[model samples]
Target: LDSVLVTLEEVTVCFSVEEWALLEEWQRELHREVTAATEQLLASLGRWNLWGLLDMGKILGGSGF
Candidate 1:
């Protein structure tokens, strides 16, 4: 998970048009995965760091990627 975040950060630093499109697709996929995981975690655990995960989704979604 840390590695994934690191790679995402690196990718966002600089990218060509093609790379940007790929990155946007990756970002959307990541957002979906995170949302699913977070929902499952909440259902099983009652409560957790949901705000952080949702905040991350918002940040990525808001970036217009």
Candidate 2:
């Protein structure tokens, strides 16, 4: 299975407002799982190293396009 961090960064950085703005019925398509998981992880790991958390996400992004 893929690491959550990797895909989370890709979505956050690359996403556009229009692309991410999900309607009520379309909410399931949003990366809710990834976003919540990342936030929780960042909080638990301590917010002192926010940049490090971001970096971990970037690494998971793989060969980014």
C-alpha lDDT of all candidate models, in order = 0.50, 0.48
lDDT of 2: 0.48
Task: Give per-residue CA lDDT, model 1, range 1-65, as digits (tens).
Answer: 35322223432333344554666667856755655665575557555455554565455554432
User: Each prediction's TM-score against the native?
Assistant: 0.35, 0.36
Q: Which candidate is the best by lDDT?
A: 1
- Error (Å) of candidate 2 at residue 58 is 23
RMSD of each: 8.1, 9.7
Off by over 4 Å in 2: 1-14, 21-30, 48-65
Deviation of model 2 at 24, angstroms: 11
Report the C-alpha displacement of residue 25, candidate 1, in angstroms. Answer: 0.8
Candidate 2: Cα lDDT at 4: 48
Q: CA lDDT of 41 in candidate 2? A: 74
